[model samples]
Target: MTITEYIQQRRMALAEQLLMTTQLEIKEVAIAVGYTSHSRFSSLF
Candidate 1:
């Protein structure tokens, strides 16, 4: 996959984990997924 596709897949996987396994805030999850902004992550997720 392209880097964009790879990152997107990872982001989705992170989103699922964030939704399923923890109480961490969205901003933290976004950063972990390599996005600096939760809004950007929210848009994609």
Candidate 2:
């Protein structure tokens, strides 16, 4: 995979972990994964 795809994969994985293990809001999780736009993060997730 391209570097960009790899990074996105990693971020999405981390986002999934956070969602499963923590009570953070979706927006907060998105920001933690380097996404500024909630809609974009949601779309990817």
Candidate 3:
């Protein structure tokens, strides 16, 4: 897959893991997943 698709898959995996394992806020999760904006992360995750 291309870089965008790879990043997207990683974002999704991280989103699920974060949501399941921690109480971190969405924005924090976005940053942890290498994104600067929650809205952009939302679209990808």
Candidate 4:
């Protein structure tokens, strides 16, 4: 895959891990994973 795709995959994976392993809110998790917009993160998640 392209580098951009790889990064996006990694970000999504980390987001999933944060969601599963922590009690952080969705917005917090999104920021933790480098996303500033919760709606965009939700779309990916």
Candidate 5:
């Protein structure tokens, strides 16, 4: 995979973990995973 693709995968994986293990909201998880736009994160997810 390209570097950008790899990074996005890793970030999404971490976001999944956070969503499963914590009470954080989607927007918070998105931000925590380095996405500034919740809409973009939602689309990616």
Candidate 6:
């Protein structure tokens, strides 16, 4: 995979882990994964 794709995959994996392992809000998790828009992150999720 390209570097961009790899990075996105890793971000998604980490987002999933944060969602599963923590009580952080969606927006917080999105920010932690480098997303600035919660709606966009929700769509990606």
TM-score of each: 0.76, 0.97, 0.78, 0.93, 0.98, 0.90
In the range 1-45, model 2's lDDT, one tens digit per residue, is 999999999999999999999999999999999999989999999
**Steric clash pairs (candidate 2):** none
Candidate scoring better on lDDT of 4 and 5: 5
Q: Estimate the Cα RMSD of every predicted model relative to the unseen true structure.
A: 1.4, 0.3, 1.3, 0.6, 0.3, 0.7
Compose the digit string of candidate 5's lDDT tens values, residues 1-45: 999999999999999999999999999999999999999999999
Q: Where is model 3 more than 4 Å wrong at Cα?
A: none
List candidate 4 stretches off by more than 4 Å: none
Q: Which regions of candidate 1 fall more than 4 Å away from where they truly are?
A: none
Sort by lDDT, top down from the best: 5, 2, 6, 4, 3, 1
Q: What would the per-residue lDDT of candidate 4 be over residues 23-44, giving only the tens digit for each residue?
A: 9999999999999999999998
How high a TM-score does candidate 6 get? Answer: 0.90
The clash numbers for all candidates, in the given order, read 0, 0, 0, 0, 0, 0
Winner on lDDT (1 vs 2) = 2
Question: Per-residue alpha-carbon lDDT of model 1 for 1-45, expressed as tens digits?
Answer: 899899799888977888689887888888877888889889988
Give the TM-score ranking, best first.
5, 2, 4, 6, 3, 1
**For candidate 5, what is the total of clashing residue pairs?**
0
Q: Which candidate has the top score in TM-score?
A: 5
What TM-score does candidate 5 get on C-alpha atoms?
0.98
After the best TM-score superposition of candidate 6, give how far the Cα of residue 20 lies from its true spot, in angstroms. Answer: 0.5
Candidate 5 clashes between residue pairs 3 or more apart in a chain or in different chains: none
C-alpha displacement of 25 in model 6, angstroms? 0.5
Off by over 4 Å in 5: none
In candidate 6, position 5 carries an lDDT of: 88
Where does candidate 6 have its weakest 10-residue lDDT segment? Answer: 4-13
Which of the predicted structures, 5 or 6, would earn the higher lDDT when compared with the native? 5
